[model samples]
Target: MAPSRILMAAIVLVGLSGFADAPQRYVVSYSVSDHGVAQMRGQALISEEGDVSVQGSDQDGGHAFNATLNPTDDGLVLVTSLWRGATKLGEPTLAMERGGQAKAEFGSDQQRVVIEIAPAD
Candidate 1:
């Protein structure tokens, strides 16, 4: 059997429309891939906060995904909890800054899931 891949992307636009040159729009792109193959992808425009999820079936088996995002005290950064089949993955944090990024990989010998968040250009 082959491994499955899931990619999620999130983009946020804040502040007034007049400020077009301003960096008010934050882009968050999530990518979950294995062996350069992608089975799922996601993108979102968040005002204050946002939630993105993807569910589908591939050659391996069925897949289910769920997640919610919330603002942090420092601003421009978000945090969300991860779960894999009732197992608490972790409280991963999301950052809009290019220097600040988060990533985590989990799975067994049969399968591997790599979750990554970037500045989304």
Candidate 2:
């Protein structure tokens, strides 16, 4: 192959490797329900290894969630903590692959939180 062509191919491969390591962005959506009634719903944008926290209050109580989007060899994992009022809801995690979606539900009938994560558009 021509020397120029070899150099161009190397440049292209390096550029593609840079893209592979580029940070990924995702949309995180959640819903907090009290006794099966929607108490709060919110959305946030996050990047790989970024943290997001959201909280809201209503007449009944307050709802809050903290989560981090982390990358893994197999897929992505959302490490999260959920809370309703002063009580801490169960810690839930959503695991998904690239270009996929995942959800984690915590709590029971009294207070519940559902978190969904997806690759951002």
Candidate 3:
């Protein structure tokens, strides 16, 4: 092989590797409904490690939660907690679909939440 051709190939490989190492970022927005009222509006960050950070506002001040996601046979299972100051308020079971939607239920299914994501504007 010619020396110039070999150098060009090496440059292409380096550029390709850089592209492969880039991280993916997604912004998810969702709402929760309770009784006949839409109670909350929130957003979450889904990272490469399947870790999530979510925050929203409702009638009860502002709320934030964090959890790690693990893939299951049925779907993605999430364990989340509510926080106020340094106190741990509640932990709940949540479910997520890869590249789809997610929901978290609270208080005996009295509350149902839905999350959806799309390309950022």
Candidate 4:
């Protein structure tokens, strides 16, 4: 099968397995070295099949964002954006860590941001 088809299959399998119930909303604090400190409140949905969806926003500007993390045989894949609607503003495939904590890195027109997510409570 093609790679895209396989990915689609995995997504479907993960969705059907009910992994989406494992995560919940939480507050995450992140640091951007030269920029400053930023905090966001978002939801993390962990599926039974190893898929994760995390979303959050900056309270000051209401700039919301979300990310979907999918675990594969190799590692994890991450997709993020800065919009609330169905349309994704920015989608970048960033590196991720397995098991305990995961991290994502992406660049925008202005700056580069790295996000780290710990296990949801």
Tell me, by TM-score, which candidate is best: 2
lDDT of 4 by residue, 98-121 (tens): 545555556553444555655555
> What does candidate 2's lDDT look like per residue over 1-121, in tens digits?
9999999999999999999888778889888788999878888888878999988887878878888988899988888877778888767887888768888777789977788988786
Off by over 4 Å in 1: 1-48, 59-61, 75-99
Question: Which is the winner by lDDT between candidate 1 and candidate 4?
Answer: 4
* Whole-model lDDT per candidate: 0.48, 0.85, 0.59, 0.50
**TM-scores, in order shown?**
0.45, 0.71, 0.49, 0.41
Q: List the residue pairs that clash in candidate 4.
A: 19-46, 19-47, 19-48, 20-47
Kindly list the per-residue Cα lDDT of model 1 for residues 63-93, writing each as its tens digit: 4454454556665455554444455545556
| Higher-scoring candidate on lDDT, 3 or 4 | 3
Off by over 4 Å in 4: 1-34, 37-61, 83-90, 105-112
Task: Kindly indicate the candidate among 1 and 4 with the higher TM-score.
Answer: 1
Strongest candidate by lDDT = 2
Provide the clash count, candidate 1. Answer: 4
Better of 2 and 3 by lDDT: 2
Looking at model 1, which ten-residue stretch has the lowest summed lDDT?
A: 2-11
Model 2 segments more than 4 A misplaced: 1-21, 106-111
Error of 2 at 113 (Å): 2.6
Query: Measured by TM-score, how close is model 2 to the native structure?
Result: 0.71
C-alpha displacement of 29 in model 1, angstroms? Answer: 6.5
Lowest lDDT 10-residue stretch of candidate 4: 25-34
